[model samples]
Target: MELAVDAKPTYEVGARKWLITITVITCAIMELIDTSIVNVAIRQISGNLGATVEETAWVITAYAISNIVIIPLTGFLGDVFGRKNYFTASVILFTVASFMCGFSGSIWTLVAWRFVQGIGGGALLATAQTVLVETFPPEELDKANGIFGAGIVMGPTLGPVLGGYLTDNYSWSWIFYVNIPVGIIAAILSWKFIKGGKKKLSGKIDYWGILALIAGVGSLQMVLEEGERKDWFSSNFIIFFFILAITGIILFIVRELTTKNPVIDLRVLRNRNVAVGSALRFAFGIAIYCSVFLYPVFVQSFLGWNATRTGLLILPSAFLTGMLMGVNGALIKKGISPRILLIFGFGMVITFAYILYRLATPAAGEWEFLWPQLVRGLGFGFIFVPAASLTLAGLKGKDIGQASGLSNMLQLLGGSVGIAALNTYITRRIAAHHADLMSNLSLYSQTSNERMQGIMLQLQANGKTGEQARQMAMGIMNGSLSTQSSILAYSEGFMMIGIICAIILPLVFLAKIKKGEIADIGGAH
Candidate 1:
């Protein structure tokens, strides 16, 4: 197998390019929406399928594992087959699988279909990115990327809200059913508008490398998605996969580095911008996904909001982000440095985290959180556009697809890691907070005595007998304290995220782009 570089294709923008862009973006949004849509429908799925809470979680995990495994391989597949043909086939596969998922009768059946759907859906993401990049000239790439970025940002933010509304108003199956119409439209548009790339034979396909990659990423994703539920490494199943992940990843890297025709071109990472951009992408993934996950859980569990209410609470941040993405896109076109935007984005996100840390309480209201979320949304707008543009700026045309695959893979992997870390951290924090709270609740303390007496009086007034009343009063007191302790734990978790983002801010200075470069790039548009 020998590596070859060939002449790059020229793209002309018109109706064809815009149509193709819309088709690919639609496909991309569908894929991303599926990733988070199930979060809100989990309870309904669990009850309807007669699965336990823990077992039902496999529905999400199975899809995620398959998605991560397939994303990196998308570039290889698109090259092997023609891009348009590959894109069409993926849509068909995803649509068919979604139908099956809706029709599934058992938990295992649904999980199986979700995994199949994920394999198809995963290609939609990186392939869509590559397609959009190549469809536009380098000059107009920022605007193209901006549109794609908006879809990426919007999908996860909208998923929980949409899913919640659908599940409450309709049924859980509607989640999958909703994709059918979107998929059909996208497929039709893709066939009509997408221009296929001329395929160059890059020697023999790296069979060994593909095997190692699947073994590595698939196992690692499974471990991350399920580890918290399985009690981390203590479970034999988790421990076994942990070993599999490490070994497979090591072998995959070695194989990629040594093989002439690697399934994924790990060598592209040698480009400095690509490498640093990938790291930042990873961090961005962590921050975004972890915040989405934690904020809903914190509000619902401690603030006692319903799914609909919690979903609505997040909408303001997302709306603010949408508005800022457009502004940032224009700013890039007007010769602004992305590094400055990146710093501002990071600062706003850290500020939002700090606000959450300080304001979260058992009795905290929606108004308390409104402004913080809006600030966080503004930060996300800053981070997404510039970070995305810079990541691919230095890569040659032939390497775009491979680089997109790798960067997207890191972002997905980072999300899984972030959620697992946040869940585990919150769990540990809850215990620590409870312990500290209990230490100050001795009966000898006047404050403790007064609280106990008040609770006892309330119970007696409710018509309980002496012995039963005292026990009920104690239970109520403990419940109140536990709720307060949980709030404290959540606050600490938010602070930790704030500190992590703050620490990463200095790295923005390391991103090297010449002054006036962005202006030159914009002027080319």
Candidate 2:
């Protein structure tokens, strides 16, 4: 596989480049923030719109689906049109879509606007990374990545917090409205400062490949997102989509491998670094997303904290992650190997998972989670910068864009899978735990009888007749069954995440990077 390096007459790292980088990063962060920000406001939107909780959830799913579908094709689109033109257009589109989303009166209308916003948002993510890399010289790539990584990590972390605050103090529409000004600024800056790359478009676009990719990724994401709610394969919709997803993905792989000019160059995977990096990126996605998804639910449902409180809990950890990103960037600039850092990061995440598994109880407090979450944040920072740096290090000019798109796609898909699988695991475990708890109850057991009697007396005192009290006591026991079941489910969920990290640990050795590979890679940065 011959690597194509499209090196233009290099320009100095002047004010223009920095300005462009900032603009691109800002756009990327805005898009990513919206992805999770709506999560906190789902209840408000549902109540106001008179939609069911399940229907309002489409607001999230629509954006995610459109995002997944468009990300892999960003490189192609950027090449077809000039990068600057494409990027500027995307900003305008995203901004307009945001307005529509905010003004939407019905669930489907909001969903439609979100989907459009996602289409524009997806382009920004990969293009922003490429813009940053090209703006910096090879030597300063680590620092550039550090800056980019900060935005990536901070966006998701801040989303819920910002959304919670906005939803509480102002209206939910403001979440979408907030993007208008940011998008306008980014668009103007990008038009002024970002340079266009020179890539000639072929005669015809790979429409088949685009369709295949959309079908494959879109269907797969839908299955992952809605599988648990719809009972996986049990629902007809899920089953049909599952088959479509599998078929589309298989066809996409075949089509990309065979097409003369592929929509997304799958051939880039021939580069060992890109391949391993993409895989590790998938794992990174799983870890980051699972923690984000589980933490809020754990705090809100089990610990009885409100959304705002849960959002605040993650603030310190986000700061830690931002701090560590800077530190890791400097370390990479020095002669430190990412392999060592990644090992430590993996261990830290496992430790964090174990902490949660052990400390998790029905009554676990916020204080109990503070230190562990901080450790996890540090671990995430350690992995994200190095993993990203190492992944794209060997790729040349056009390959850089392709590799970025692929890695981003895997990360998104991994998150979807992680959330779906964890939800399913929690649901199943809850049932099993409830069964075990119920089986332990017996009339002959003194403690069980005493507990039942206390419940019966309490019901009677609450104005229940003797017969009603007896029935109410049984209902109380059943309710405790659910309470204990939930606790056990959360505990097992944490353990499952730990086991997953452990399973992936050995793959680090398979990365084929030597002790000093960081310097070799860093030199290209």
Off by over 4 Å in 2: 1-7, 11-14, 514-525
Give the RMSD in angstroms, all C-alphas superposed, for model 2: 2.5
lDDT of 2 by residue, 439-511 (tens): 7678778888999999999999999999999988998888888988988798778777777777776666766
Query: Which segments of model 1 are wrong by more than 4 Å?
Result: 1-8, 515-525
Q: Judged by lDDT against the true structure, how good is candidate 2? A: 0.83
Clashes of 1: 0
Highest lDDT, which number? Answer: 2
Residue pairs of candidate 1 with colliding backbone atoms: none
What's model 2's lDDT at 147?
81
Angstrom error at residue 353, model 2: 0.7
RMSD of each: 2.6, 2.5
